[model samples]
Target: MDFIFFDADGRYFNFLCLYQILYKPVILTIFSAMQTMRWAFMLCTISQLDVLIYNFENMKELVKAGNCEINEAFKDGFKKNIVHHCAIIQFVNTIGRAFGGQILLFFMINSFIICTTAVQFFSIPNPLNNIMELVWIFGFLFIMIIMLYIDCYFGTIITEKGSQISMTVYCFPWIDLKQDLKKQFIIFFVRNQQDLVINASKLIPVSMTTFRKVMNWTYKGFAVLNQMRK
Candidate 1:
């Protein structure tokens, strides 16, 4: 521990002590706010994915009644669901665009933090002396990874569920419907052949593939730091 200054009386003040006394609470409060925001983002993303999955199931159920008897109500309901699905996709994309920069910045900073923390952990001379500090850094790094994974996981689910809509349409009892209705259904199915993807500002997609890339970047950074330390 280094002293910041010493008085004529030989009394010393430490920067770390000042940090604990005057800055720790502020830092903790900022971290708390960030964690809250992340939780809200995750909740909203997952809810949208759940809505998508529910709509897919509804479509599948609609087609299960294979009596060529899709009532007006059922048709209306299906149309409404299609609109609802579109709305969800739009909502997610809007959010992705809005937070893309923030998320990208967070991941970049997190990668650097991981690299530095790993280097410190490996270079520490006395494990017992800094064990608590290492644990704190590791805990934060783990939380960040988990949060990133969750965001990617929900986005992947949304993509998969959206794509599954076409499969559900294919499994429908199109042979039992009137020719006109069958043609309309075919058009709808064709429109849905392409999957809905939510991208980060239309750049990187939010998926496991991106998550894996981020982790790889972190590892590469850590290795580079280790080499530099030598």
Candidate 2:
């Protein structure tokens, strides 16, 4: 009777363990899906900007080659490009407003996670004996770093492409254009002189510079943790 009761208890414990093991994968799957969606949205926005940049470049080339005729139709095209540019900036601003808070939160959480994980991994006395543990921790760290990098990389691309628009317009042979067209070109040039940048919560500009700062903070945090452990 005692043996039977012990076996029954062991079986119940095993069932609970199995349930937990199965549940974790489901949660990870949901998280992975969400990350995929976020990346897809970012890529879509980048592609739209790329298309607009291409249009601007093409127009610049035509103007430079003296193929562009400065007439009413040309004026219309110039105005249209300016409107399109403004529309894209507005769209980017909308995205920034919508996801700015979430982006800031992500950066904070990832920085903390990276610092803590690095400290814990480095603090282990015998990593060879704990190969599986090391691999799991390393994988988590790598994923966080990659995710943060993707966000910053995309932001840098946006800034570079945006600034290119001003350069393209500036290179156009505006001196040969009619008085009115030259004035329009000057306005466009001045307007685009400010590079487009996406900000996090209207505070932090999301760029490679921000990425470097985050890494610096992460290192500082890791150093502090190590000192505390010692």
**Top candidate, metric lDDT:** 2
lDDT (tens digit, per residue) of candidate 1 on 1-230 = 23435453453335456655867688889977874674476567567656655665565465555532454424655666667666766777776777777667766776677778778778877878888887886787788778778767866876776776667656655566677767777777777777666676677787888889988998998998899999
- Which pairs clash in model 2? none
lDDT of 1 at 171: 64
Span of ten consecutive residues with least summed lDDT in model 2: 1-10
Please write out the lDDT profile of model 2 over residues 95-196, one tens digit for every residue: 689778878998999999999999988987899999999999999899999999988888888888888778766765567678888888887888788878
TM-score per candidate, chains pooled = 0.75, 0.84
Report the lDDT of model 1 for residue 155: 65
* Most accurate candidate by TM-score: 2
Residue 42's lDDT in candidate 2: 65
Cα misplacement distance, residue 47 of candidate 1 (Å) = 3.3
List lDDT for all candidates, in order.
0.69, 0.80
